[model samples]
Target: MPKSLHRRLLEKGWSEDEIERTMQMMYSDEKREKHAHFVSATHPVIYWVGLVVAIVGNLLVAVTLIPFLMILNSTQLYVILGIVGFVFGSMFNLIIKDIEHVDQTHHIVAGVFIPAIALITVYIMVSVANRFNEVINNPNPHNAIVLSAVYLITFSAPYFVYKIKDFVWERKQKASEGA
Candidate 1:
């Protein structure tokens, strides 16, 4: 079995008092090990590729659905888009780590908000494109440009929020340690 946290800290020459204080402030070794394992098991390349596929695939579907929206009833169109959004969002949630927090808030967002946002985003894009006569009739060079930009922004939003939260938490931890 692995050594306990206290034993490892002692091996590292941490003072007894400091070790006790740190132990009180942090999770137990088992919990830390579990978290570490989870982090280590994640693959950045696979995650990024999955996210790209989710974003671009959903966006392409959205573009394709634009002309059909005029023929289909609003309810039908929404249902189809909702299904597409749910699939892509679930794919995204599965690919990304740390999105499923202990409180289950992340899970809720992954299951609900991601899909809703995706649906809304696609609707807006299609609406705007139709208004401006930029309907995506067939694949064009501009399709790549537009899809890349939109997908980049959509995929980056959640990560941006996570990074901001991490930065704030780190700053707070530093402040607390200094104090």
Candidate 2:
């Protein structure tokens, strides 16, 4: 059986009258039924892959601190990461919404995955940057604070953007009351 709409309606607390009315309205138009098929829309692989790419590409903060030519100190490099984080966080917020297949689990998955990758990258970053550290004989510091910030700020960004989006949206249901 596909499913029983009547039973489903009863389970959902819809009164008999409401269920009948809703069923009548939904099935009344044969043209509308033809437009919506039962196969379900499946997206291409790349469409799904793009979400991964966007998350990975956006959270590449350690990359800024990894360049050989850019001779800024670790502190300066950390600042650069912050600047990049803001831009990337915003981009991530935008990209996740645009992607069709992404969900809360995807963000939650990234919550763990991005930081794990980030930790490894930061280790590499500190190692690479430490090569230029002649004045202060500092060993490899993982900068856990920065990494935790990466963990929190990166995935939480979309939610913050979503909240702000809510604040900015205006409903046009009613005309101007102030004449």
Per lDDT, the best of the predicted structures is: 1
lDDT of each: 0.58, 0.56
Clashing pairs in 1: none
lDDT of 1 by residue, 1-179 (tens): 99998999999999999998898668777778988978755644444455457657766776776666545554564456556544554457455544344325544544454445555656576555555444545331123234334444554455556557879999999999999
Per-prediction TM-score to the true structure, in the order listed: 0.38, 0.46
The deviation in Å at residue 140 for candidate 2 is 10
Give the per-residue Cα lDDT of candidate 1 at 110: 44
Q: lDDT tens digits, residues 1-179, model 2? A: 76698998898899999998888888777746665543223333433575567546744555555552146554664566655666655665565554424456655564455445555555555555556453355444345456446544654566577866655553322234332
Alpha-carbon RMSD, each predicted model? 13.2, 13.2
Model 2 compared with the native: what TM-score?
0.46
- Least accurate stretch of 10 residues (summed lDDT) in model 2? 170-179
Ten-residue segment with the worst summed lDDT in candidate 1?
Answer: 139-148
